[model samples]
Target: MRTLEETLAWVAEGTALCRRAMAGLDETSLLPGWTRGHVVAHLAGNAEALGNLVRWARTGERTPMYGSPAERDTAIEAGARLPADRLATWFDESARALADAMAHLTADQWRSEVTTAQGRTVPAVEIPWLRAREVLVHAVDLGTGVRFADLPEPFLAELRADILARRGPANVPGVHGDPAEVTAYLAGRPHTGVTTTDGAVAEPLPPWL
Candidate 1:
Protein backbone atom coordinates (compact mmCIF):
# COMPACT_ATOMS: atom_id res chain seq x y z
CA MET A 1 0.00 0.00 0.00
CA ARG A 2 1.02 3.65 -0.10
CA THR A 3 2.25 5.67 2.87
CA LEU A 4 0.09 5.73 5.97
CA GLU A 5 -1.17 9.18 5.04
CA GLU A 6 -2.08 8.02 1.56
CA THR A 7 -3.65 4.84 2.89
CA LEU A 8 -5.67 6.83 5.43
CA ALA A 9 -6.72 9.17 2.66
CA TRP A 10 -8.09 6.21 0.78
CA VAL A 11 -9.87 5.24 3.95
CA ALA A 12 -11.53 8.66 3.97
CA GLU A 13 -12.31 8.50 0.29
CA GLY A 14 -13.85 5.08 0.71
CA THR A 15 -15.92 6.21 3.65
CA ALA A 16 -17.33 9.06 1.63
CA LEU A 17 -18.06 6.81 -1.26
CA CYS A 18 -19.80 4.34 1.00
CA ARG A 19 -21.78 7.09 2.69
CA ARG A 20 -23.01 8.33 -0.65
CA ALA A 21 -24.07 4.88 -1.65
CA MET A 22 -25.79 4.45 1.66
CA ALA A 23 -27.53 7.80 1.41
CA GLY A 24 -28.94 7.04 -2.01
CA LEU A 25 -30.28 3.69 -0.96
CA ASP A 26 -33.82 3.15 0.28
CA GLU A 27 -35.21 0.48 2.58
CA THR A 28 -35.32 -1.73 -0.46
CA SER A 29 -33.10 -4.77 -0.50
CA LEU A 30 -29.65 -4.30 -2.07
CA LEU A 31 -30.73 -6.46 -5.05
CA PRO A 32 -28.78 -9.58 -4.18
CA GLY A 33 -28.66 -10.94 -0.65
CA TRP A 34 -28.83 -7.88 1.64
CA THR A 35 -30.48 -4.55 2.23
CA ARG A 36 -28.64 -1.23 2.02
CA GLY A 37 -29.12 -0.97 5.78
CA HIS A 38 -27.36 -4.27 6.24
CA VAL A 39 -24.32 -3.16 4.29
CA VAL A 40 -24.16 0.18 6.10
CA ALA A 41 -24.49 -1.52 9.44
CA HIS A 42 -21.69 -3.90 8.58
CA LEU A 43 -19.44 -0.98 7.70
CA ALA A 44 -20.14 0.66 11.04
CA GLY A 45 -19.50 -2.54 12.93
CA ASN A 46 -16.31 -3.09 10.98
CA ALA A 47 -14.96 0.36 11.78
CA GLU A 48 -15.56 -0.27 15.47
CA ALA A 49 -13.94 -3.69 15.21
CA LEU A 50 -10.89 -2.30 13.45
CA GLY A 51 -10.74 0.45 16.04
CA ASN A 52 -10.38 -2.19 18.72
CA LEU A 53 -7.22 -3.39 17.04
CA VAL A 54 -5.90 0.15 16.81
CA ARG A 55 -6.44 0.64 20.56
CA TRP A 56 -4.59 -2.60 21.23
CA ALA A 57 -1.58 -1.34 19.30
CA ARG A 58 -1.58 2.07 20.96
CA THR A 59 -1.97 0.74 24.51
CA GLY A 60 -0.06 -2.53 24.19
CA GLU A 61 -3.09 -4.52 25.19
CA ARG A 62 -4.33 -7.68 23.51
CA THR A 63 -7.68 -6.34 22.34
CA PRO A 64 -9.50 -8.60 19.98
CA MET A 65 -11.45 -6.96 17.17
CA TYR A 66 -14.77 -8.67 17.89
CA GLY A 67 -16.02 -10.16 21.12
CA SER A 68 -16.98 -13.24 19.17
CA PRO A 69 -18.11 -14.22 15.71
CA ALA A 70 -21.66 -14.57 16.95
CA GLU A 71 -21.67 -11.15 18.56
CA ARG A 72 -20.31 -9.59 15.42
CA ASP A 73 -23.05 -11.17 13.34
CA THR A 74 -25.68 -10.09 15.83
CA ALA A 75 -24.44 -6.52 15.76
CA ILE A 76 -24.61 -6.41 11.99
CA GLU A 77 -28.10 -7.89 11.96
CA ALA A 78 -29.47 -5.56 14.63
CA GLY A 79 -27.69 -2.54 13.24
CA ALA A 80 -29.23 -3.21 9.86
CA ARG A 81 -32.62 -2.49 11.32
CA LEU A 82 -31.71 0.99 12.54
CA PRO A 83 -33.19 4.06 10.87
CA ALA A 84 -31.31 5.03 7.71
CA ASP A 85 -30.12 8.39 8.99
CA ARG A 86 -28.81 6.96 12.24
CA LEU A 87 -27.19 4.02 10.49
CA ALA A 88 -25.35 6.36 8.17
CA THR A 89 -24.30 8.47 11.11
CA TRP A 90 -22.93 5.45 12.89
CA PHE A 91 -20.98 4.50 9.81
CA ASP A 92 -19.38 7.92 9.44
CA GLU A 93 -18.82 8.52 13.15
CA SER A 94 -17.21 5.19 13.82
CA ALA A 95 -14.79 5.76 10.96
CA ARG A 96 -13.93 9.20 12.29
CA ALA A 97 -13.33 7.85 15.77
CA LEU A 98 -11.07 5.20 14.31
CA ALA A 99 -9.12 7.81 12.37
CA ASP A 100 -8.76 9.85 15.53
CA ALA A 101 -7.36 6.85 17.36
CA MET A 102 -5.00 6.20 14.48
CA ALA A 103 -3.80 9.81 14.49
CA HIS A 104 -2.58 9.61 18.07
CA LEU A 105 -0.44 6.53 17.60
CA THR A 106 3.18 7.01 18.59
CA ALA A 107 6.03 5.83 16.42
CA ASP A 108 6.48 2.80 18.64
CA GLN A 109 2.81 1.97 18.42
CA TRP A 110 3.04 1.75 14.66
CA ARG A 111 5.27 -1.26 15.00
CA SER A 112 3.35 -2.85 17.86
CA GLU A 113 1.89 -6.25 17.11
CA VAL A 114 -1.87 -6.80 17.28
CA THR A 115 -4.12 -9.78 16.82
CA THR A 116 -6.79 -9.83 14.13
CA ALA A 117 -10.11 -11.55 14.54
CA GLN A 118 -8.73 -14.30 12.35
CA GLY A 119 -5.91 -14.81 14.87
CA ARG A 120 -3.17 -13.33 12.69
CA THR A 121 -0.43 -11.35 14.42
CA VAL A 122 0.59 -8.28 12.45
CA PRO A 123 1.90 -4.79 13.00
CA ALA A 124 -0.57 -2.06 13.84
CA VAL A 125 0.29 -0.44 10.53
CA GLU A 126 -1.77 -3.10 8.81
CA ILE A 127 -4.93 -1.74 10.42
CA PRO A 128 -5.34 0.90 7.73
CA TRP A 129 -5.19 -1.72 5.01
CA LEU A 130 -7.82 -3.71 6.82
CA ARG A 131 -10.11 -0.68 6.94
CA ALA A 132 -9.38 0.33 3.38
CA ARG A 133 -10.09 -3.14 2.11
CA GLU A 134 -13.35 -3.43 4.04
CA VAL A 135 -14.60 -0.04 2.95
CA LEU A 136 -13.72 -0.43 -0.71
CA VAL A 137 -14.40 -4.12 -1.18
CA HIS A 138 -17.58 -4.17 0.86
CA ALA A 139 -18.74 -1.07 -0.93
CA VAL A 140 -18.72 -3.11 -4.09
CA ASP A 141 -20.44 -5.86 -2.19
CA LEU A 142 -23.17 -3.34 -1.48
CA GLY A 143 -24.35 -3.71 -5.07
CA THR A 144 -24.28 0.06 -5.46
CA GLY A 145 -22.53 -0.34 -8.78
CA VAL A 146 -19.15 0.56 -7.31
CA ARG A 147 -17.45 -1.92 -9.57
CA PHE A 148 -13.93 -3.24 -9.14
CA ALA A 149 -12.82 -1.08 -12.05
CA ASP A 150 -13.79 1.89 -9.92
CA LEU A 151 -11.18 1.02 -7.26
CA PRO A 152 -7.88 2.86 -7.42
CA GLU A 153 -4.88 0.99 -8.85
CA PRO A 154 -2.70 1.21 -5.76
CA PHE A 155 -5.44 -0.19 -3.54
CA LEU A 156 -6.07 -3.00 -5.97
CA ALA A 157 -2.40 -3.96 -6.07
CA GLU A 158 -2.15 -4.12 -2.32
CA LEU A 159 -5.45 -5.95 -2.11
CA ARG A 160 -4.21 -8.51 -4.62
CA ALA A 161 -1.02 -9.00 -2.66
CA ASP A 162 -2.95 -9.41 0.59
CA ILE A 163 -5.38 -11.93 -0.89
CA LEU A 164 -2.68 -13.94 -2.66
CA ALA A 165 -0.54 -14.09 0.45
CA ARG A 166 -3.48 -15.38 2.44
CA ARG A 167 -4.55 -17.94 -0.17
CA GLY A 168 -0.97 -19.06 -0.73
CA PRO A 169 0.39 -19.73 -4.24
CA ALA A 170 -2.05 -19.39 -7.14
CA ASN A 171 -2.82 -23.03 -7.79
CA VAL A 172 -5.43 -22.61 -10.49
CA PRO A 173 -4.68 -21.05 -13.85
CA GLY A 174 -4.92 -17.30 -13.45
CA VAL A 175 -7.74 -15.07 -14.62
CA HIS A 176 -6.64 -12.47 -17.16
CA GLY A 177 -7.86 -8.94 -17.79
CA ASP A 178 -7.12 -5.39 -16.75
CA PRO A 179 -5.22 -5.30 -13.45
CA ALA A 180 -8.26 -4.06 -11.56
CA GLU A 181 -10.54 -6.70 -13.05
CA VAL A 182 -8.12 -9.50 -12.31
CA THR A 183 -7.69 -8.26 -8.80
CA ALA A 184 -11.44 -8.03 -8.44
CA TYR A 185 -12.07 -11.56 -9.61
CA LEU A 186 -9.29 -12.89 -7.44
CA ALA A 187 -10.58 -10.95 -4.47
CA GLY A 188 -13.86 -12.87 -4.90
CA ARG A 189 -16.09 -10.42 -6.76
CA PRO A 190 -17.75 -11.37 -9.97
CA HIS A 191 -15.50 -10.51 -12.89
CA THR A 192 -17.61 -11.32 -15.86
CA GLY A 193 -16.02 -11.60 -19.33
CA VAL A 194 -12.73 -12.62 -17.74
CA THR A 195 -11.08 -15.74 -19.09
CA THR A 196 -8.63 -18.23 -17.67
CA THR A 197 -5.71 -19.62 -19.66
CA ASP A 198 -8.07 -22.44 -20.57
CA GLY A 199 -10.89 -20.02 -21.42
CA ALA A 200 -14.14 -19.51 -19.48
CA VAL A 201 -13.77 -20.20 -15.79
CA ALA A 202 -16.12 -22.92 -14.52
CA GLU A 203 -15.10 -22.22 -10.93
CA PRO A 204 -13.45 -19.43 -9.00
CA LEU A 205 -10.53 -19.60 -6.61
CA PRO A 206 -11.18 -19.37 -2.86
CA PRO A 207 -12.17 -15.98 -1.44
CA TRP A 208 -9.53 -13.42 -0.39
CA LEU A 209 -10.89 -12.67 3.09
Candidate 2:
Protein backbone atom coordinates (compact mmCIF):
# COMPACT_ATOMS: atom_id res chain seq x y z
CA MET A 1 0.00 0.00 0.00
CA ARG A 2 1.08 3.56 -0.55
CA THR A 3 1.74 5.88 2.38
CA LEU A 4 -1.22 7.61 3.98
CA GLU A 5 0.10 11.00 2.92
CA GLU A 6 0.26 9.98 -0.72
CA THR A 7 -3.23 8.44 -0.66
CA LEU A 8 -4.65 11.51 1.02
CA ALA A 9 -3.21 13.67 -1.73
CA TRP A 10 -4.79 11.37 -4.30
CA VAL A 11 -8.19 11.71 -2.66
CA ALA A 12 -7.88 15.48 -2.53
CA GLU A 13 -6.75 15.79 -6.12
CA GLY A 14 -9.58 13.60 -7.40
CA THR A 15 -12.19 15.67 -5.60
CA ALA A 16 -10.69 18.89 -6.92
CA LEU A 17 -10.63 17.58 -10.47
CA CYS A 18 -14.25 16.41 -10.25
CA ARG A 19 -15.28 19.85 -9.09
CA ARG A 20 -13.42 21.43 -11.97
CA ALA A 21 -15.07 19.08 -14.43
CA MET A 22 -18.55 20.04 -13.25
CA ALA A 23 -18.04 23.79 -13.48
CA GLY A 24 -20.47 25.83 -15.61
CA LEU A 25 -21.84 22.83 -17.43
CA ASP A 26 -25.46 21.83 -17.61
CA GLU A 27 -26.44 18.26 -16.74
CA THR A 28 -26.50 17.07 -20.30
CA SER A 29 -25.13 13.54 -20.53
CA LEU A 30 -21.96 14.42 -18.66
CA LEU A 31 -21.33 10.73 -18.07
CA PRO A 32 -22.53 9.75 -21.51
CA GLY A 33 -25.39 7.52 -20.33
CA TRP A 34 -25.94 9.83 -17.37
CA THR A 35 -26.20 13.57 -16.91
CA ARG A 36 -23.79 15.87 -15.14
CA GLY A 37 -26.26 15.98 -12.30
CA HIS A 38 -26.27 12.21 -12.13
CA VAL A 39 -22.49 11.97 -12.00
CA VAL A 40 -22.25 14.64 -9.29
CA ALA A 41 -24.93 12.89 -7.34
CA HIS A 42 -23.12 9.59 -7.65
CA LEU A 43 -19.84 11.17 -6.54
CA ALA A 44 -21.47 12.71 -3.48
CA GLY A 45 -23.15 9.44 -2.66
CA ASN A 46 -19.85 7.62 -3.12
CA ALA A 47 -18.17 9.76 -0.48
CA GLU A 48 -20.91 9.01 2.01
CA ALA A 49 -20.77 5.33 1.17
CA LEU A 50 -16.99 5.21 1.55
CA GLY A 51 -17.34 7.02 4.87
CA ASN A 52 -19.11 3.94 6.15
CA LEU A 53 -15.88 2.06 5.65
CA VAL A 54 -14.07 4.68 7.71
CA ARG A 55 -16.72 4.36 10.39
CA TRP A 56 -16.28 0.62 10.43
CA ALA A 57 -12.55 1.07 10.86
CA ARG A 58 -12.92 3.53 13.72
CA THR A 59 -15.57 1.62 15.65
CA GLY A 60 -14.87 -2.00 14.71
CA GLU A 61 -18.46 -2.38 13.64
CA ARG A 62 -19.79 -3.97 10.48
CA THR A 63 -21.41 -0.97 8.95
CA PRO A 64 -21.79 -1.50 5.26
CA MET A 65 -21.07 1.02 2.55
CA TYR A 66 -24.64 0.55 1.38
CA GLY A 67 -27.59 -1.54 2.34
CA SER A 68 -28.28 -2.80 -1.13
CA PRO A 69 -27.44 -2.04 -4.73
CA ALA A 70 -31.00 -0.96 -5.44
CA GLU A 71 -31.03 1.45 -2.51
CA ARG A 72 -27.71 2.80 -3.61
CA ASP A 73 -28.93 3.42 -7.12
CA THR A 74 -32.09 5.01 -5.77
CA ALA A 75 -30.14 7.36 -3.55
CA ILE A 76 -28.03 8.41 -6.50
CA GLU A 77 -31.14 9.05 -8.53
CA ALA A 78 -32.72 11.10 -5.76
CA GLY A 79 -29.68 13.29 -5.38
CA ALA A 80 -29.31 13.54 -9.11
CA ARG A 81 -32.38 15.76 -9.44
CA LEU A 82 -31.19 18.39 -6.96
CA PRO A 83 -30.72 21.89 -8.24
CA ALA A 84 -27.24 22.70 -9.48
CA ASP A 85 -26.07 24.70 -6.46
CA ARG A 86 -27.44 22.16 -4.02
CA LEU A 87 -25.78 19.35 -5.91
CA ALA A 88 -22.49 21.18 -5.77
CA THR A 89 -22.85 21.66 -2.03
CA TRP A 90 -23.58 17.98 -1.63
CA PHE A 91 -20.42 17.17 -3.56
CA ASP A 92 -18.18 19.42 -1.47
CA GLU A 93 -19.75 18.61 1.88
CA SER A 94 -19.85 14.87 1.36
CA ALA A 95 -16.16 14.80 0.57
CA ARG A 96 -15.46 16.81 3.71
CA ALA A 97 -17.66 14.52 5.77
CA LEU A 98 -15.73 11.46 4.62
CA ALA A 99 -12.50 13.24 5.47
CA ASP A 100 -13.81 14.00 8.94
CA ALA A 101 -14.74 10.37 9.51
CA MET A 102 -11.35 9.19 8.35
CA ALA A 103 -9.51 11.68 10.56
CA HIS A 104 -10.98 10.01 13.64
CA LEU A 105 -9.27 6.71 12.96
CA THR A 106 -6.28 5.83 15.13
CA ALA A 107 -3.27 3.95 13.83
CA ASP A 108 -4.62 0.64 15.02
CA GLN A 109 -8.07 1.39 13.73
CA TRP A 110 -6.53 2.09 10.36
CA ARG A 111 -5.51 -1.54 10.16
CA SER A 112 -8.96 -2.99 10.72
CA GLU A 113 -10.23 -5.26 7.97
CA VAL A 114 -13.45 -4.51 6.15
CA THR A 115 -15.66 -6.20 3.59
CA THR A 116 -16.05 -4.12 0.50
CA ALA A 117 -19.16 -4.07 -1.64
CA GLN A 118 -17.37 -6.50 -3.84
CA GLY A 119 -17.12 -8.84 -0.85
CA ARG A 120 -13.36 -8.62 -0.80
CA THR A 121 -11.48 -8.46 2.48
CA VAL A 122 -9.10 -5.54 2.65
CA PRO A 123 -7.46 -3.41 5.30
CA ALA A 124 -9.08 -0.11 6.21
CA VAL A 125 -5.97 1.56 4.84
CA GLU A 126 -7.37 0.84 1.38
CA ILE A 127 -10.38 3.13 1.83
CA PRO A 128 -8.58 6.24 0.65
CA TRP A 129 -7.54 4.57 -2.58
CA LEU A 130 -11.01 3.13 -3.04
CA ARG A 131 -12.64 6.52 -2.75
CA ALA A 132 -9.93 8.11 -4.83
CA ARG A 133 -10.48 5.58 -7.58
CA GLU A 134 -14.17 6.37 -7.82
CA VAL A 135 -13.65 10.12 -7.73
CA LEU A 136 -10.81 10.30 -10.22
CA VAL A 137 -12.07 7.69 -12.69
CA HIS A 138 -15.62 9.01 -12.74
CA ALA A 139 -14.40 12.57 -13.07
CA VAL A 140 -12.94 11.64 -16.40
CA ASP A 141 -16.09 9.65 -17.15
CA LEU A 142 -18.08 12.89 -16.92
CA GLY A 143 -17.43 13.55 -20.63
CA THR A 144 -15.98 16.95 -19.87
CA GLY A 145 -13.15 16.25 -22.29
CA VAL A 146 -10.64 15.86 -19.49
CA ARG A 147 -7.96 13.78 -21.15
CA PHE A 148 -6.64 10.65 -19.46
CA ALA A 149 -3.17 11.97 -20.35
CA ASP A 150 -3.57 14.44 -17.49
CA LEU A 151 -3.74 11.78 -14.76
CA PRO A 152 -0.69 10.80 -12.73
CA GLU A 153 1.18 7.96 -14.41
CA PRO A 154 1.34 5.88 -11.25
CA PHE A 155 -2.37 6.21 -10.65
CA LEU A 156 -3.10 5.46 -14.29
CA ALA A 157 -1.07 2.29 -14.06
CA GLU A 158 -3.01 1.13 -11.04
CA LEU A 159 -6.32 1.82 -12.75
CA ARG A 160 -5.17 0.05 -15.88
CA ALA A 161 -4.30 -3.08 -14.01
CA ASP A 162 -7.54 -2.92 -12.04
CA ILE A 163 -9.74 -2.72 -15.12
CA LEU A 164 -7.78 -5.44 -16.84
CA ALA A 165 -8.19 -7.76 -13.89
CA ARG A 166 -11.91 -7.21 -13.85
CA ARG A 167 -12.16 -7.47 -17.62
CA GLY A 168 -10.29 -10.78 -17.79
CA PRO A 169 -7.87 -9.47 -20.39
CA ALA A 170 -4.60 -11.06 -21.48
CA ASN A 171 -1.28 -9.25 -21.96
CA VAL A 172 -0.82 -6.00 -23.87
CA PRO A 173 -0.68 -8.15 -27.00
CA GLY A 174 0.09 -6.27 -30.20
CA VAL A 175 -1.11 -2.90 -28.89
CA HIS A 176 1.06 0.14 -28.34
CA GLY A 177 -0.12 3.58 -27.44
CA ASP A 178 0.28 6.59 -25.20
CA PRO A 179 0.19 5.39 -21.63
CA ALA A 180 -2.89 7.44 -20.86
CA GLU A 181 -4.87 6.19 -23.83
CA VAL A 182 -4.01 2.62 -22.99
CA THR A 183 -5.09 3.19 -19.41
CA ALA A 184 -8.34 4.75 -20.56
CA TYR A 185 -8.97 1.85 -22.88
CA LEU A 186 -8.43 -0.45 -19.96
CA ALA A 187 -10.98 1.57 -17.98
CA GLY A 188 -13.53 0.92 -20.75
CA ARG A 189 -13.50 4.51 -21.97
CA PRO A 190 -13.20 6.05 -25.40
CA HIS A 191 -9.54 5.55 -26.25
CA THR A 192 -9.12 7.22 -29.58
CA GLY A 193 -5.72 7.48 -31.34
CA VAL A 194 -3.99 4.62 -29.56
CA THR A 195 -2.00 2.40 -31.96
CA THR A 196 -0.97 -1.23 -32.09
CA THR A 197 2.65 -2.32 -31.80
CA ASP A 198 2.49 -2.98 -35.54
CA GLY A 199 1.78 0.75 -36.07
CA ALA A 200 -1.92 0.33 -36.88
CA VAL A 201 -4.55 2.43 -35.12
CA ALA A 202 -6.30 0.27 -32.52
CA GLU A 203 -10.04 -0.20 -32.57
CA PRO A 204 -12.47 0.68 -29.80
CA LEU A 205 -12.06 -1.70 -26.91
CA PRO A 206 -14.78 -3.21 -24.76
CA PRO A 207 -15.95 -1.78 -21.43
CA TRP A 208 -13.82 -3.26 -18.68
CA LEU A 209 -15.36 -1.57 -15.67
Model 2 lDDT tens row, 48-126: 8889999888888899989999998898888888888999999999999998888778899889999888898899998
Candidate 1 clashes between residue pairs 3 or more apart in a chain or in different chains: none
lDDT per model vs. reference:
0.80, 0.81
Q: Pick the candidate with the highest TM-score.
A: 1
- In terms of lDDT, the poorest run of 10 residues in model 2 is 23-32
Model 2, residue 111: C-alpha shift (Å)? 1.3
Clash totals for all candidate models? 0, 0
For model 1, residues 153-196, the per-residue Cα lDDT tens digits are 88888887778777765554566678887887787667776688
Q: What is the lDDT of residue 11 in candidate 2?
A: 89
Q: What is the lDDT of residue 21 in candidate 2?
A: 87
